[model samples]
Target: MSTSTSTSTVSEEYVSTASRPSDLRITDVRVANLHGVPFRSSIIRIDTNQGLVGYGEVRDQASASYALVLKSRIVGENPCNLDKVFRKIKQFGHHGRQGGGVSGIEMALMDLAGKAYGVPAYALVGGKFRDTVRCYADTPSLLDPHEMGERLLERKRRGFTMLKMDVGISLLWDVPGALIAPAGSRDDVSTMHPFTGIQVTPKGVEHLASYVDTVRSIVGYDVALAADHFGHIAIDSCIRIGRALEPFTLAWIEDLIPWQYTDQWRQLTEAVAVPTCTGEDIYLTENFKPLLDAGAIRVVHPDPATSGGIAETKRLGDYAQEKGIAMALHLAASPIATMACVHLAAATENFLALEHHAADVPFWSDLVTGLPRPLIQDGYITVPDTPGLGFGEINEELFRQQLDPRDPVFFAETTHWDGEFSHDRLWS
Candidate 1:
């Protein structure tokens, strides 16, 4: 794909050229499900006669229908006219996770275009600012203090100086009971259904504190400890939990309150000495401006897939930097998005750390081959200087092993509804 720009008083011309006489046709778009994972994602490949191909992933799980519908609109478009194609398709798709299809397709096209032009994806987004991207190890949920200590040590051994742990499971210590209790009731509130479940009980809080104490003792004060995945609890409950975990000197308490509660986040951030962070589920950079402007969070957490892919994520980080707020990326799922995050992190100056969920997956690092640099070393990831995402090929053997036999990841081609749904009037 080639890029060209021509300016005129009456009009402006910007066109991208495919290497061959024929345009780059989206030959195939496939969706694959990783075994034992929560959701299925769509991966699009745009192929050209020049033997150039581009790849992109749509963040859709349980919502594969949206991706299938998008394939129809993109199959015949020239992959080189990415912006034009993205705008055109986005007009028809504007609600829910369906936006992921358009966004994912855009990412793939950009990757392809960069390869076609012999440049890195970061180069396509202007240029790069750094080479090595800092990564943080996300510690899994642990029920026992010993288990938690072991996880922390493992992360240290992996060369990760920053670690995040689950501190909100105290509400689940009771079985056959609700996850969170009512505002002031000590009695079992399990009967309250989803409304009054318990997220942190007195006993559960003590257990969490003991666990944090254990982790602190093991990792010591040198490494950074962060906490997240606190089940939904009241603002007061979050403040209490934040204060309780203070001895660990956590880097931040993530998503303490739901992301939409800006004022509550402000209160929580102010109530405790620990820094507060959120924003993984938030949409575009525009959505993040409010939280950053209000100082509701000290650090901005954006998952590139959820926040409009690489370009938009970098824009969000640049905006956060302008506000003097640090940025930490939240990533989960396949290496497609993780590699994209690495490129974006490498280009942004305010980057703090990138999440590596597949760090434990033995073949996860090998899923993509021909990486410009080793995937990890001493807890740091070296960014690839190669064109596009710098991935040589997909490890079919590993992907096959991890494929969910029941679901079997494959793209389901189908047309979307052309008209508004009947339920649209109900909300109005």
Candidate 2:
């Protein structure tokens, strides 16, 4: 019982009391709302009793309440038990931004589990298929096709091998005889594609194809070009536009119609030579089944922040792979979410590319530390093998500078949320 003998008996391999994984408990969950770090986004911090912390981001433009409401459900649970906590809280989630809360928390859990066990997040998801994840830069639509081509060329000049641009019916709204839609319905975003009775006239189809022609001519065939935001056009319009751009060999046409329209997706996929893609709003793996089962699309684009975070998106990618469909991530949030996507893309075999939506945001890489200076290199993110999401620290100073004015609090005490309760059970 002598102190000297007791000290000598301790093994070198013994874990320190401070790092005990089993004893780890969720102490609190807080939010930092940031605005125009490009766009509004909420970053979630899950604190533990052991002084360890993990970070995640709500989908871009999503409200912070999406995460705060779930704080009470996880206050005392183990962060490492990801699936258990996920199952307990997932019922509260739904498709689109509503899923941000459960998805962000899942990411935080993956971070904590990785840090606790001392492995990269990808390792926790069965390891990686690649070291570097190729990124595709998103170039917004410009009225002038040549100007848009020049913008895409700038992306190429920055070393991006893949690029995407907006090609939709909106561009044809003012053009005489370009589009055939109800007089006042063109601007109404609430209208679904099929109900709008929108048709792309031959003139509109030609105009849309001209933009792709201009871009493809400037960027050349070596670059993998993609298009998105088809503006809720009907199936016939989508097919017409798709066929018109087939000569350009687009990587894929994204969200051609709503993801819920699997039958329409199949029709669009079959009618057009260009590959059809959707599912950025989809929430879970099973939700992607109908599209996959019917061979509705050639590529499945899921934003990890919306598609159930780390493990679930990986599962979605695995399922897509089995059905011979490729996956490309959709992300427009902070570097925290970007790293999460990089980890998922690395682990998923059929991952085609991870969308880099903030390539133009100068301070995007500055928001996180312990990574390379330029977060993206030559249109690819080198997957970090470091523990968790691979960033050593959050650049708090930068976050403070970019805080959303409406909710200027940064990681403020969330005690009010701790008392919130809901009967979340779906079955007896």
Winning candidate number (lDDT): 2
lDDT (CA) per prediction: 0.70, 0.90
User: What lDDT score goes with residue 202 in model 2?
Assistant: 97
Any idea what lDDT model 1 has? 0.70
Quote each prediction's TM-score.
Answer: 0.82, 0.97
Tens-place lDDT digits, model 2, residues 22-122: 88899999999998756888999999999999998888888789899999999999988888999988887789999898898889999998988888999
Model 2 segments more than 4 A misplaced: 1-9, 12-16
Backbone clashes, each candidate: 8, 0
Residue 91 of model 1, lDDT score: 46
Clashing pairs in 1: 55-108, 171-199, 179-198, 180-197, 180-198, 180-199, 181-197, 181-198
lDDT tens readout by residue for model 1, 1-428: 12333234224324444353235566555565565322455455555556677766666452544445556566667776666666655543332354566556667777877777777888877677888888888868777767787878898887888888887754354534324555554544333212444456565666667778887898888988888877656776677778888877888889866677678778888888888999877767777887888888988997776677777778899999999999999876566766777788888889899877656766656667886334778888787878788788776777666665765654333233222133222234
- Model 2: weakest 10-residue lDDT segment is 11-20
Backbone steric clashes in candidate 1, count: 8
